[model samples]
Target: GGDGAEEEQWSQPGNDLSLPAVNQTKGKCCFSLCPGIKIPKVMDFLPNILTINDSSLPQARTRCLENGIGYREKCFYFVEDEAEWNRSETFCRSLGAHLATIDTWQELRFLLRYGGSLHYWIGLRREGSAPWTWFNGSLFNNSFQIRGRGQCAFVNGDGISSDWCSLMKYSVCSHPQTRPTGSRRDPEVWNLT
Candidate 1:
């Protein structure tokens, strides 16, 4: 009868018992009915399928060039034999860009698959006792992605080990939009200014 009652309650049409909603009550309903079975929300699931190719690369590159900051969508591969970290950072800055920001496992995998040998630095670094921070000084809250021991971070070509930032290494940069010379603002900011 309890099982039937629980099922009936869950099946109620107007009930929006999402995981987030259910979690708020400390799993009171879950423990009572389905003990030991974890019910995850749709958002909690990781995507199993993803499309990766060269066609999207150009669009990403163009967007990075247009915006001065990295846009996350455009993942670039760098030549480890060609440039060092400082050189890479300078090169990216010259083109109105900065080191890549690794926010997702998908992005990390893509970077490692594309970026060949000679580890490249990512934009994340630890600041004081606080957690890691992106190059833009944003706090990193997502812990689902893997991280290495190095204080300065780099994504490996094989996507396994982390490398030092100061060491001479190749890197990929992402720019959000092309920065305007005189104003130091992107078109979006200019409009608002």
Candidate 2:
């Protein structure tokens, strides 16, 4: 109250009190990120909507995709060449990423349109009659109907399909922000989330 500086701080940019309230969540919120725009629940997006531009990311801990495509809060690297599921997984591991995971209907829709006619191996792996699991050891939520019967899943023009793991298919690697820097023995404590 002694000086005019007290009043000036209330109007300061990025001040705690000046910021809008946002729900704290682990993953990205589509509603809050893009206000007023309606995103259809069903699959399919206009080709070229995401654009081909790459987002540069800091490689502070683990090896990362240098030319990865950014969608939402994740980075994706689409390997054009076909390879076996295990080989594809190895390839993704080298880049400190994993096969792309479809955690939501929106993600499934995006992947369906992104891959178009070409098949891209995703992270879904169902062992025998067991539930489908993501590459990160998370269970698939059954967000949408999965087609075909096999040990692995891939995305194509139609939707998510299951096929033999030995089949040659392109891979979609996902770079999550919280991915660890190294194996469990050499774990480095750093939070990217």
Runs in model 2 with CA error above 4 Å?
1-66, 177-193
lDDT of each: 0.49, 0.63
Sliding window of 10 residues with minimal summed lDDT for model 1: 45-54
Instruction: Candidate 2: give the clashing pairs.
Output: none
Worst 10 residues of 2 by lDDT: 183-192
RMSD of 2: 15.7
Q: Judging by TM-score against the true structure, name the best candidate.
A: 2
Q: What is the lDDT of candidate 2?
A: 0.63
Best lDDT among the predictions, by candidate number: 2
Model 1, 1-193: lDDT tens digits are 2322221112123323212223322334543444532444312321210111222121223343332323355535353444655567677676556778766677666777766565777666664445777777898676534366655567776664444555676667764443222212122212211
| Cα lDDT of model 2 by residue, 103-152, tens digit | 66776777777778999999889899999998878998888777998899
- TM-score of each model, paired residue for residue: 0.47, 0.59
**Per-residue error at 71 for model 2, in Å?**
0.7
Whole-model lDDT, candidate 1? Answer: 0.49
